[model samples]
Target: MKKHIVNLWAFIHLVAHRFATDGVAQTAASLTYTTLLAIVPLITISLTIFSAFPAFQTVSTNLKIFLLENMLPESAGKVISVYMFQFSENAGKLTAIGTVILAITAFLLMQTIEHALNGIWHVRRARPWTQRLLIYWAVLTLGPVLIGGSLYVTSYFTSLTLGLGHEVHGATLYGLKFTPILLTVTAMSLLYLMVPNRYVMARHAWLGGLVAGVCFELMKTLFSNYVSHLPSYTMVYGAFAILPLFLLWIYLSWMVLLLGAVITAMLPQYAQGAMAGEQRVGYQFDLAVRTLVQLSHAHLRGEVLSLVQLVKLTHIHGEMLEQVLISLQDGHWVLRTNQGWALARHPDKILLRELFERLVFDAHHAQLDLGVIVRQPDLNLSDWVRSSAQLKLGEPCR
Candidate 1:
């Protein structure tokens, strides 16, 4: 118990240090700034679109009040409000001219957002030009349309509920109580549908979105009613008061976005592989092992290795490790001898080892040097005729 506790503490400390490192801090700050900039444009772009349609303009106003006006810093709220006011005025005249310009700006903003978020998701932009065009169109054109429809549906429900409440209890409880929840659900669903790159399961997305949306709406309401009531920072920080508030709001918004992603990702795993199609093993051992075996077999045609050594050195479990070895042996990539396993000498195993070592090294040090740890004699192996699958980059075989 003591040993486990000590190890756990050490691990946690290491993680903290890793994140607290200058590079990590700088990266985090950069992402935060990028996200904040993206949010303003994204919100403005959406509002501009809704303002083009008279019926949807009212919905946009409600959304703005709910999301941005109520939650943002007073300065930011003022800036956005003024901009939207100008947009509303121009939107009332020469519909297509302003609309077209705003549409182009929104599309550009979406692409910018996509580029940033895609990096965070670790997904590559593999689609060609035509596909990119289609995807962008779907996000920019179809997105607002969907939101408009949802808002209309919500308004209808609100009216029906309010009418029923008045008739039954002589109070508007149902509409007042349920409207926020309905709005939250709508917002969450939109986020889930719009945010991710790879395909997300609908059920998980919906549940996550709903939960996050509800929490966000509640927080917005609470913040507006309580936080906004607090005295302005001018007395506290003087001229710099609004700065901290803006930063705080930015941080809070980022936290909300992260929480939404986490909840959505976790929902599929809530029941421990019940929802996911195939449960991959911890750390993706099977994948790593397959790659290891393939590289070894490709390079060392008759390299011999003890099963015990393979298991210990590769950190693979006994059964799965044996299966891999047996597979390689059966395939004639390796030969079983009395002493150890032997394989035909190919050059690829060395390349595989180098690749694996690089991965391990990167995992440990994300770029930090650990003194002589990587240069130690124990880990530094030279070449051998019988040393199958032992390859080193830029080092001659001994």
Candidate 2:
């Protein structure tokens, strides 16, 4: 239990570091701007899909109302919903070319979200354009249907239970209190699972989603209270106060979502407390050696490694591992393949001296005598990088 607690704390620290360094806030701000630009078009697309099916028309309206009320400050929700409805309604009258433009605008939002999530997952490749087109359109078309259907089913049952009059009112009240949280958790878990290019374990997604969802609820409550109690904003912007508050909520929403992605990506290492020591005493040399050792083994097995594979095996932070890979590439010892990364030269041909010089030797180490170190007979200055289990980068076949 004590170890688990320590691991949990370490994980939290690492998650915070990754979130801050990954420019999550900047991504959120950028997404906020894109969302503001794309909101009307996105709403228009959903409304258009609903228009095709008369039964879903009311589902569309209900979904919008539920989202605005549960996800935004009450004052901001009312004003912004009114404005969005008006804009979406106007969007319905666009010409054919205008409709294509609206769809592209929505695509831009999807692209931004995928890019941000992929960064969290350390994914270096994106889905092919054909695959992206299919996935993006499916999301644009079917996502609302799923959310609306779930909401409809729950509300239907609640309203049905109300046939007993006030007898079930308390149960219904409790249901109302919990529904938003459940929905938030489900939505977040799905986002974490599906947005990243790599595969995500269900448990990690659930854990991440649970934390982010709870935080979202807590933050929403506090933000709403602040906006309500503090009249300063209203006194200043007056009717326009809704704009800034709405934008602020959007930014906060993106942050929570992105933080969840970061947690999900790093959860495996966190599970073992592998990331507890964020910094190492000799990170550069140690990382370089470990990387070379791993690549050497994989080469003998006729396998190459993807970035995700390297992160999994090394238990090193993705960004740091990437930097080490870049250094090795510069030394012409590693190659990036279409399949992944591989050893550019046989491990037996590489020298430990090269690694030491590149990683350990520094301008600050001018006091160390190069000739004296080279003159040591037993040191075997030309030792193979993976020469032996002792040296570990390699040795001769014999």
> TM-scores of the models, in the given order?
0.51, 0.78
lDDT of 1 by residue, 1-398 (tens): 99657654654454344334423334435556765444444555566678778778678756655445444555555655566556555554646775566556555655654554343333433334566567777776566666666666666666786777654233445654565566556655655555555344567567766766666666656555554677566578976665566566555654554455445544433323222223432233343455356446533454455654664456543334444556554544556566555553454433433333443443244232322344442544333222434444444433
Regions of model 1 farther than 4 Å from truth: 1-83, 87-101, 124-126, 157-176, 193-195, 236-247, 266-398
- The C-alpha lDDT values of all candidates are 0.52, 0.81
Candidate 2 residue lDDT tens string, 165-210: 6555577677877887988898889888877777677898999999
**Candidate 1 lDDT score at position 236:** 84
Give the lDDT of residue 98 in candidate 1. 58
**The candidate that achieves the highest TM-score relative to the unseen native structure:** 2
lDDT of model 1 at position 317 = 37
